[model samples]
Target: MKSILLCFGLLFISFLSPDISAVRADYRSASENQEEAEKLYTELASVSDTDEVLLLGYKGATATLMAKYAKGVSAKTAYFKEGKGLIEQAISTAPDNIELRYIRLSVQENAPKIVRYHKEIDEDKQFILDHYPNLKDGETKKYIKGFVSQSASFSEAEKQLF
Candidate 1:
């Protein structure tokens, strides 16, 4: 019986082990840890388990961040354009993915006005508001709620939903 119990415990741990290292949570700390962003992006790009759309979105986000650190105009332009292209593909692949929309929203909020990347800001916000309640992941809902609470883009009533 003890051996059987040990086997079950090991199985349980194994089941949870993948989630511990999945790409979904891997990039969540990128904002706070920019130094690791490039490595994380490289590692994530090599992963096949994650949804391709989500992976592409994060890859684009990472490229955008890298663009900020680029030393030359040509390098910066290349990274930014590549990132934008990857994000556009992700959006096209999963138009209704709220998480992807949130990623895009965050990007647009901080992007320069001259870039004209704000076109989807309102649409993404509305989509997030409408779909937030239906999200199944409690942790993600909490993250979104925290984000909304501090975001200038969301109105008072809109923040109340999260």
Candidate 2:
């Protein structure tokens, strides 16, 4: 009977939500590592449209980051456009989500000038600074602070706010 119970417990655990750790991991690593980016992208791809909105945002980030691994400008453009669609969709779904704003800000900050995707950099930065104090997740707050501290997008004075 004990062994049967144990088997049932194991089966129950297996049915729980998947380990979507990539969402919690640093997106910066995905920017530089193709394998990491692909894994993150794949992981986030499993997130349903009805799930947490930020998961979609992370998917967008991973897709955009994947462009770095593409072989040519045209292919890179396709990836960027696809990622941008997902990112924008998430933002539209939850306009006030700070994490989604951060995702967009990071993408805008890093995208090449020719892509003309920098329009939202200042807006997203200010939004983050203003809403950051209200963010509830300690882990996410830490990630945002760390990213801002290192990104050229945020000035030394601005970094202090994070």
Candidate 3:
């Protein structure tokens, strides 16, 4: 009985051991993708022609992935903001782009923390809600409540924007 229990315990430990390796592999892959994204963004920045759509798409996708890999709120916020700016530029360049809009919505949804303005994020929340009203009722209600709760905390200038 003692040998059997020891064998079972060893088997369980073996089963669990690969998860750490997998996590390490994922981190490595994310790092590589981030580097690739930086290179793509540099290339895109140099292009003056309208045919840089593919490069812009690559930049957006990589920015999204970098945001996904961000382990903390500040890192995630930076990546999301960068992605949002790129998406906005892309939209302006192609106003009728449904794909760009979808990617923007995705970034907003997965952001690690809401964009802070004057220690409040209501305007950002409202912008998201305005663009993606089809989000679930519970989500909408939560943002509404957050916006209302935080309204008093905003500065005079911030209040005018909302």
Candidate 4:
């Protein structure tokens, strides 16, 4: 019975893995396919199996993209505010997460001055740079490398490490 239960659990976990991939896929396509990205984020945001903090961050990112494409000032403001709030919640929940810090830094770097969200750019940039070598995930390291290569926040000296 225990073996049966374990097998079932493993199967269930395997099924859930695709959603994680879907999130990553949608995130990567966000710039080119904002509509699909928004739908994926909205769907994933409600999934109980998804990490709350990650979902929140994804929601924040999707909302930011949505705001960029939104036609009206009111809609843009609402999306930006919602996205910012979700990101802040995620950051507060996982203050030590370098990935979360990176998300915040990216958001802050791009946010308009009117939003007043750029204050954390330097802090998060430093945290990511200081801790880059310690990140064990290959995908994360690749992402950080790609981000730093294009980011204005990282000095040439800092980016050379990647």
Give me the candidate number with maximum TM-score. 2
Deviation in angstroms for 8 in model 1?
20
Residue 110 displacement in candidate 2 (angstroms): 0.5
For model 3, residues 4-123, the per-residue Cα lDDT tens digits are: 999999898566332322332332244357665455444344433254442354355456566666789788667766655666677678754333443344444444454531221343
The runs of at least 3 residues in candidate 3 whose Cα sits more than 4 Å from the true structure, single-residue gaps closed, are 1-51, 71-74, 116-162
Q: How close is every model to the real structure, measured as TM-score?
A: 0.77, 0.84, 0.37, 0.81
Mark the 10 consecutive residues where model 1 has the least summed lDDT.
15-24
Please report the candidate that would top lDDT against the real structure: 2
Cα RMSD for candidates in order: 5.4, 3.9, 15.6, 2.7
Alpha-carbon local distance difference test for all models: 0.74, 0.83, 0.48, 0.77
Clash pairs (backbone) in predicted model 2: none
Give the CA lDDT, 0 to 100, for residue 14 in model 1: 57
Which residue ranges in model 1 land beyond 4 Å of their true spot? 1-28, 47-51
lDDT value for model 1? 0.74
In the range 1-162, model 1's lDDT, one tens digit per residue, is 999999999898555433422544556566556666676666655533244567778778777766766689888788778777888888888898888888888777867676677898999999999999899988778767776787889989878778
Models sorted by lDDT, best on top: 2, 4, 1, 3
Q: How many backbone clashes does every candidate have?
A: 0, 0, 0, 0
For model 4, state the Cα shift of residue 3 in Å: 6.3
